[model samples]
Target: MSSLEQANEVYNKYGAYELMKRGISEGLRHLSAPYENLQTEDQWVGAKYYGNFAGFHNNFGGNLAETKCRTASGNPPQIETTQESEELEAAMELRHNGYTKIGNIYDEDVIDEVVSRYNNIIENKEHTKSSHSNDPGDGNVYIRGIDSPQEEYFPEAEQLVTEKVKNILRNYYRSHIQIRNLRAYRTHHIPPELMESKEVYNNHWHCDGKTSDHIKLFVCLGETTEEDGPLHIMPKKYTREYAKRNASFDRETDGAPNNVVEEHGEPVKFTGVAGDVMLANTQTCLHRAGVPDEGRSRDLVQLYIAPSSEPLPENWIDSELEGADPNVWSRLLKY
Candidate 1:
């Protein structure tokens, strides 16, 4: 029998879909060779030039004079003494330089109205009832762009994206950063129950792992304290190891894609005040949405940036939302 026919026979014995998935993964590995190291468990793979990990500003740079923080004593400030503390410090420093906070990114009254509208959408009889038994393909609703505030949701968000783009480019200069061929995406959430359980909550760290260029901003509408299930980020150092072990690219066997990160590893959680934004390099940092406690909800506006020069997936729009399974707005982008 021909190889195709023989393979079909094997698939028939096992399972066709599962086999195809594996094949696709293998093929991608061949197409994206240098990035194969990204799929490995070696966290230091990307940190060859940039040392240290974790925290606020890590995705930017390392050992550079600009990336370092000055201590209160006029010495280079060491945010903390532990390994994790150092990582967090680096991340914070990067965030400071790359991202700026525009408090009231939305009008207060308008934000209140929007928040209420979203709350009602979730509390509507259908949404509440479906919560128990249904797994809506893309949540109960999927909005591409908010019509209410066309400026902040799309135009202004797009403008702020410029700064984010600068950050991504600056960091990649010191390391291997590939811009994924995808467009920027915006997402909104108004669910309170999602933050209650680890299993039911937005537990996965979603990303645009396919393309090399990716930087996402998680914008908050309300106070995003621990009660709202603050995001947890695994320092770059840890994720570098993750890239090697989990995100490493492989060759495709048939049509199946390679495996990404496993869902079992522990993730670092994040906490932010209202109006505080989390700027992230999805490829280098592994993060997940926190679970909201009782009577609380999370309202976040997420924006992704992609450069004009890249070739996004033919099904970029649909594929970009791969991680939206649990959280409709969780996704990846490139710029």
Candidate 2:
């Protein structure tokens, strides 16, 4: 029998509890390793396995009725108009599907201004500080140390924290949320030879190790099409199945296999015009960035957020909330 068939047989025979225990065992083993000694991929494995185990327990292991009660606010936000109703429905879809896109949230002027700023930065690369990049000179340039500038260039980013957004987040998290990090980057088309040598600019499907409560708001700074390296994401249900099939979490790479993904459901690709915003629970979904077509690039502004005791503020993009830390599990987990 095939490996997938074997996984299915094991799951059917012993049930989900058995799979959970196996996953937890592997997770504990990784967690027990010394942090300093682990390589980048190993560290990712440690955090992803253990963090996902924690997320599963938090969301599913407890009392079913109690979980429902806690998640369901007895008094939901009142919806009077069509827009309000649609926003609420989108919020529900986000919770259920692990992602949802808000179309054309920003006007053309806003997109133009943001894109112009990005172009200036790109042209004047010598003066700019980059956070990281896929290659030294060519692929996926991520602008660094521009937190304040991002706020000025793309004030529409603040729209991510508006009343409607806050309501959606609050309803989903069942708690107030705060901006964890903000980033702006441009994805340039890498050479085909380089693409063959390396992973397709995060094209390998993997889950971000952040906790389940975390959601990333991806703002397209310009018109984004399938050729522009759009994001591809699997729903939460398929992610769980993928996890079960690889309960040991001992894959060769951090990404899921294409065959396994194909065996499950189709991935949803995020492709839309400028100003579209995609809200994704990256921790719960399996996702990867598509490779942009040659001679084309994609510009984006990303916001990372998580549940917090403090309520979201209007000018959250400029707030003093903690920045994006590479060691995500360190902040969220005791170990």
Candidate 3:
């Protein structure tokens, strides 16, 4: 059975209160569910006390439901270190002191393993060539994770990078914030050779606010040095000003760019080492990728999560009864 199924069985056998008390008792309080079921109006009202309505892991109970269920929005708290390592400690310090970088979370061998596999895929040259999926050259385009987690590649690190990044988010935001999903994003390549390739493939400055309230964790897998292409992040102070004019965040649509000029006089560039994650507040911050270089490549694994009280879309595809897994697609199509 999948980890999710095992968890559901435990919840069914032991009641939600029991699960909450136990999950909360641990420092892992962030993993506790706010209600037995969020489908009921009463349960949703209770979620307000906890602030926000998005689930922590994106799979609430099982699937998205008006009165039934959906995805989890946070990381699995049980799988964490007894004590944070020095790199994590440094990241916390930097976050506290205004800004900093985390180091060595991924060893050299691990990077080699992922890169080795990533290199073997058919580059998304077609996607890059097509105007429909054209990325502005900020990074390479690739289809990753079809048959991933190959043991020989990085056997010991199944979800190591993902989990570590999630843990950092859990600790930083606390239970007040919910983390939804962590997926390794694959890009073929970014647009042109300009540091100003703001929306290489997609245009305009926007956030994930429409779909969620949680922050986005962007972890760089390859070098993000200046010329190699890095992500551009608008400071928290300028979010509202920019959001006031931008048009689209849904990848299916197109819109105008929200011309954001920082009061500080220059756009902020977020570039870093491999394994470094850019924790962005989706509500206000506007970000874009820098142009990609032929010599320098970029890969990012993103984690998205939100609080559990937010009402899901009335037409979300994952709102079926069986489960959130796409294997239930045939069943969902009937709806």
Candidate 4:
């Protein structure tokens, strides 16, 4: 029989319980080796298969093995310093809730400088790279070149990567971290005709497929109201419950049906002014971009982060950030 057929047969016969058994076994084997001695090939295979299985099991129920391995392998050496009370609280909230937001973290002048640069790019049609299309589109325009500008038109964008933000990320990952990717974007209202046929960028509820340690920092560049298409994210517990009930995995294109929302809690909308920064674990949380009202749009900068063995440098945003794709699973093994 074909591999696909064999896999289906096994899945139909043994289901999730068998998957859990194999996944836990692999996780235990992984824990047997010290983090420093683990092989990259083994880490890759485990992360691609058994790690995903652990995620599947956690969505259906909870998995202690995942947590145990993460803590033992990922935690960094404790440093000596009195962390700011607010940063400490934010870190705690992120750990418990899968997300946290800090308002007015940047000065007005910094916000203006970033916004002005974005406006200039939009007016001049200068950005030639983006996530979806090279040029701006109707639903989303994720400009890619602004962060790595040749002339350094606006240095204030780096203000988004402050020490406080880095501290929060370090605390969340429990290890040294590095920026995986950084870009600015604008999400605009979808035309009514295309709403039914065309998918609005990230409007479908989904969990990122990257490693479980991945998180993102979103910095709003302007006043974001309900009409401006802010983000909506389900709390971690509610997302798990929904996943269990619906057998949802990475993506749910139709979003949570009314029945599911009624059983689970409603998603929280991210609405705030310029200079607001929000940190979210996209790999564990179910979230989607909101569609703006007609003639309205949302502008923001997003920083993707992953765990690393080395401490983040002071000039990380300017010099150390990696490209859009990085060896995330391999990086996880370095802790």
Candidate 5:
């Protein structure tokens, strides 16, 4: 079998419901061939980088002076307007900057219920496991395929996307509105002890898929305040200019050159209250989860989308999870 075929085997066995369950395991297996010839490898980033656990961002230079990501420190951005205007303005912002925010999209009652269920998974040590350790003041619990406490939680919340927001996004993302991928995470600010140990890896600026057609929607289930790990993003135009210069380059393993950073100004942080829906052109802008001051908590539902017909480099998880038993997967969920 070819590498892709062999890789698909793993995905077939323990893949889907667990999401990245086999990451650390498979990553270790690949380490046997140290200094992998990834460039010559025919696989895509989802398989080569994430599947094998290639440390792309590990090469990040922590020199802030060389960074083009401007630090935006202040109160969070504010948006106060009627429903129709908010939708239009957000759509326009998404067009211009590759991101936009719509507030109070879901009823507060629903938001609270979702947060309450996730709180048990993320906060309780016995039931919780870190998706990836974060020493940089930010951490997340991957609750998509693995620890879905309530299967109905996500399918029901799917209603939150309503007709209005779908109309706003369908054109920008360039695909029929379908939930191509779904990742719901509950994040937290790591304690000082471990925080000191985490290198400036994720805190550094980066984009999801370089020069790919993708859109990510973030549903803030809890308050994302200035000090609670708010997301900061560079404007779309700057991100496009930066992407153009380094098209086809891997962001996880590289940084913006000095000349490029000099031009791309600081990114703006979007700190939204519960029930705020934020849409982002994942490939068009550089964004990261800012470190929360003290130890505040933040929870979010991340819904991913790509043009339905766009040829996505086979996502390791999506491919593997293809035939997950819905009834069995649902049974594994907890409340």
Candidate 6:
């Protein structure tokens, strides 16, 4: 069989986790070459989180989740000796410290179309096979789940990322701003039964990644308030401090240290109407999920973009994303 055929068998029989592992082991020489040539010569400064890109190694609970699947007691937590000598590179467009917020970014006319498209795929459960469940301590935390294909994103919603987003990208990325992932999600649903459920350990303080690399644009699709689980993110000062210290807390299971919050002050929680936008670097600044009120829910669309425009592997095509638009996701995923 051809090498590509081998990759397909691994992907089809195993999963993305195994495919990624195979890539790192067998294709690291080819993979590292492209990533090494990234050049950034522009006004916007570039920052590296985790010192170097750790890729799958950077993942939280990647092993613990599987360990729990095999045995009851999860693996013991390890002390992370990274994150010393923090640097805060300023982006001209980032607001409220590390993100930019735009209120009422869309009108009903545009929102109705976007929401309708998102719901059709999610409600019908047409996951791209890349979706997985999150353990919300008590049960499946159903609010955030798998991703719908980008083909589901309508043209009207595409217009939302034009001028304002272009400027933000220019200020944030030194090289060309290439979008990495785009998906719409239904956040926590507050069913009557879940109302009495215990708070998830994940609903506390955490950062998305170790470094200041990826940028995420989060859009709210419905009415949101503090009662409905508002997003809380640390402002600049605390973020800067955390940058220089060793990673003290478990990002996947632990909340932000009480001392950090105490010294940096409380996180800024957002409350807004539909069509609100919050841009954040989840890699550097600590953030936590909002808890929607009982019986209430939230719709969110997120765009993850990065600077590198590396080439994907040849056999990368055998993986899922069968229904994804080649024009969109093809440009996004660079193995």
Error of 1 at 236 (Å): 1.2
lDDT (Cα, tens digit) per residue for candidate 6, span 1-335: 99899899988888888687656655544554453333221001121233111122322222232222223212222222223311112244363366767556565777777667667766776652322344445545446534444634333346446445544554444334445466666666544454344334246565553224457777776677877777777765465555435333433333533334446457777667767877777655667767676676666777665544332223332324332111211222332
- Estimate, for each residue in 229-274, the C-alpha lDDT of model 2 and write its tens digit: 8888888777766665554443235453354555657888888876
Estimate the overall C-alpha local distance difference test score of candidate 3: 0.41
Off by over 4 Å in 6: 1-3, 6-26, 29-96, 123-133, 136-141, 144-157, 189-201, 242-246, 252-264, 308-335
User: Model 5, poorest ten-residue lDDT window?
Assistant: 326-335
Ranking by TM-score: 4, 2, 6, 5, 3, 1
Candidate 5's residue-wise lDDT over 1-335, tens digit each? 99677668767765664435444444444553443455323123322332211123211211121121112112112223355575556767887777887667776677777666655555564334355443233444322122433233344445456656665654443334344455555555554555344433255456553213346778776778888777777776775555555445443344422224335477677688777888886544667666666556556766665333322232223332122111211111200
Candidate 6, residue 168: how far the Cα is off, in Å: 1.6
Question: Please, what is the whole-model Cα lDDT of each candidate in the order they appear?
Answer: 0.38, 0.60, 0.41, 0.61, 0.49, 0.50
> Across residues 93-120, which tens digit of lDDT does each residue of candidate 4 receive?
8878889987777767777877887767
Candidate 5's C-alpha runs over 4 A off are 1-89, 125-128, 133-156, 173-175, 190-201, 242-264, 309-335
TM-score of each model, in listed order:
0.40, 0.68, 0.47, 0.68, 0.56, 0.59
**What C-alpha lDDT, on a 0 to 100 scale, does residue 90 get in candidate 3?**
37
Which has the greatest TM-score?
4
Roughly what TM-score does model 1 have, to 2 decimal places?
0.40
Better of 2 and 5 by lDDT: 2
Q: Give the clash count for model 1.
A: 61
**Best candidate (score: lDDT):** 4
Span of 10 residues, lowest total lDDT, candidate 3? 326-335
Q: Report clashes for each candidate as comma-separated counts.
A: 61, 0, 51, 0, 6, 5
Candidate 4 lDDT at 212 equals 62
Cα TM-score of candidate 6: 0.59
lDDT (Cα, tens digit) per residue for candidate 1, span 2-66: 86886686577658774565456445545645643444333244334322222112223221212
